[model samples]
Target: MEIDEKDERIDKIDQILNDEIDIDVNQEGEEAEFSSLQDKYQINSGEALNSSDIYRIAAKESTRMIVLVGPVASGKTTMETSLYQLFQNSPVNDFCFAGSYSLQGFEQRAFYTRIKSKGNEPTTQRTSLEDNQAFLHIRLWNRNNNVISNLILADISGEAFTNHIGQVDEAKISFPFIERADYVVGIIDGEKLCNKKTRNSIVSEMIEMIRTFWDAELITDGCVLQIVFSKFDLFSKVENHNLILEKIKQQIVARLSELFMDIEYYNVAAMPSTIDEFSVGYGLEDLLQGWVRKHVRKSSRKMEEPFDELTEYDRLYYKFLGELNE
Candidate 1:
């Protein structure tokens, strides 16, 4: 009886969502198709950091695409906002902020967190799942190398990652940028990792996520995988902090060591707690410096080409066939 009731409720919700979508399509035009949903709902659409502009920038210079993956409330937004604010105001190590294509978009995400309430501490609003296509763009100028590089950081809602956690094929479909990403940042909530009850779930989800990436070939041997423990300020206060960190390494990192070649770990306190509002973004600069170094030094993921496997005779045959077809 409970299962039936649950199914009925799901059916009702599905119907309502379909109805709303139909209404939206009808209101727009008959020419509007279901495939256009991204354009209609994606936050990047008609914004400064839209896909078209980012692609154009990529064509001109090599842009390091880093995708952030984590569960809901894993501090993805907070890290992004804090990083943006830091880049805007301060110089990270030696790299100076050259410019950004999406300054206004950065402001939109960072503004709310900067606001302070009289009685209550300000919280960063959850990044909506609807805005999957949006990315925060940061460009840095290296004084030592005299090279300018752009960092395209993708922030998909944590719910998206969790929803497709174990679904390997579905994860490939959902996270299309994984194929082109230079680095994958697996953001885990440090506070949750410290809690005994939640630790298992977090570790399980991360393991599954890594499996999905490996199975889908989105992450290969050479690709860099970064495991970040966010909200470390809270986690550090716990008495069993060392034990929790060891567990994470043993359970999560040790288990997946075979799948990736270069795996790095970092702990970050991205935001200030109510008690230490003045010390905002403690331990975040190190993370940013590491990220920037990767962006500057890491090579792009090499795509496997079929021609590499072809024999000399087969190559000639294909060339002849191509000429005939032409």
Candidate 2:
């Protein structure tokens, strides 16, 4: 009896939706009829949004696209994996999250080929294939006070940002997908930064690469430049390593500010290997909690400043320049 009632309810809703669509077709020349049908459709749409009505409303209005960018071995993939593990099977009451059923990484080449081949055709797939290594794109849904579905994620290649690609031209490179994102994640290797001898080389390369690839508009919008410092455990060495970390972060922030004054930064910790100990999961709650408070906070379950916001060396150089000017 319960099943029958559920089927009946669905049937009635379908019938109403169908009837309205039909009315819209027939009312083509009649503005009044079109308006009436629109109102009816919107009312029915409201019912589909579920309980945490506001979140659903927000999700629809703003489909969040997470763009993960970083160097070849900066643990971007590891971070993606950890994030997926957190929200994958978690239960939520009302809405279904839109994500790849498989835990996969995005393949950029394949995605570009497919999109370009389509040549303006509409995709039948709810989410396009090769959409960001399967970990960079996500579509989320909210239900009651709980959230459901891990949302889709896509991760692009690190090579794209390694070289001077124009901002507008770079936007075109990602095309339709770039058009979809509301957030971004920039992964950094903290282990590398905390090493004074290697810090300058990597940090400078990352800044140049950012300009060579990535879009400036991406810099402007709800784009949160999450500077996930992977392999954070490597930085726990001694006093000097701590000093190195702070200096490098400030340098990066300064470079970004030079380009566009509005960019935001973040630190992310990821386990680089499947090894025991020196892992990143302990006391991860605080990290996840902080992530939830940000502009692009959502999950299947989980999860800066300058010179004090760039490098101490950069500051010293500036001071040197001041003396020269004097």
Candidate 3:
């Protein structure tokens, strides 16, 4: 039998794999050893990523960074897990769930809401202050355009924001990601908004937090801000919900309009207490659509930077391939 060019290449590759790589295919438990090697290199996914992991992803392709800002127990984690859970049933908006690097992270937070936990009401696990800076990643495929968007949602603890209230210098140092963020979501607890005593204070504190970021230069006038009122089911229980919501919106606009040119509001009952009355992941479709719209608009005017100085891998992955695709 004559060896063709393709066969010659395959044989050479096999020779390199067996000889140069020194793979003992005939050795006992070779499969087990290969699995061990994979584990040794930490090749598995499903864990929340850190800053270094995010950098690696960004270097490969463009990613949208979304930072959720709020006080503790304000539904930030719930909102994140709810978005992930939404894809479990069907596509969100027009985006389909392609995959996730942090499936374990999402499931861990959503465990309490599952029937296996046997809880009377769905409750989200509060994000710990220690893991406040972790990023939960999801890759969504757009049905209409056949485009893939990599979204990294920062699960920042509410304590992180509250502790740095009025502390601009500290906030600047702590939240460097805010400068690169595509969206900064400020979560307002709807239950607190319904309370007359806490309503004014919550509104004032939220404004002050934004001001601190503005003074620190972490959030610029160009930054897109999403004001999210979570647990709307509880807030809507109040008789004058519309009036109160209007007042809150007016207050936010009056305080933040000068600092943020793009400010959008969303009322979501993520994991609502009254599941029958309100659907799970309520109002999140609009939020997802808004993110896609803003991202498209931003990408149009954004300039591509030179990757000549970057590593060969980064250049190959991002510069060459990314530009060619564009």
Best by TM-score: 3
Model 2 residue 193 lDDT? 71
Best by lDDT: 3
Which candidate, 2 or 3, has the higher TM-score? Answer: 3
Candidate ordering by lDDT (highest first): 3, 1, 2
Q: Give residue 155's error in model 2 in angstroms.
A: 0.7
Clashing pairs in 1: none
What lDDT would each prediction earn against the true structure? 0.72, 0.48, 0.81
Tens digits of per-residue lDDT, candidate 1, 223-276, equal: 678888888887888897877788778876567776665677888887867446
TM-score of each: 0.72, 0.51, 0.77
lDDT of 3 by residue, 1-326 (tens): 35696687577557655765554555555444664675568864688888877877778765888888889999999999999999999998789998888889989988998999999878988777788448998889999898888889899878889999999899988888888788889989999988899999988888888889888988743568899999999998999899988998999998888776578999999988877788999988888887766442221122265655556675555533234233
Q: In candidate 3, which residue pairs clash?
A: none
Candidate 1 has an lDDT of 0.72
Provide the clashing-pair count of each candidate structure: 0, 28, 0
Better of 1 and 2 by lDDT: 1
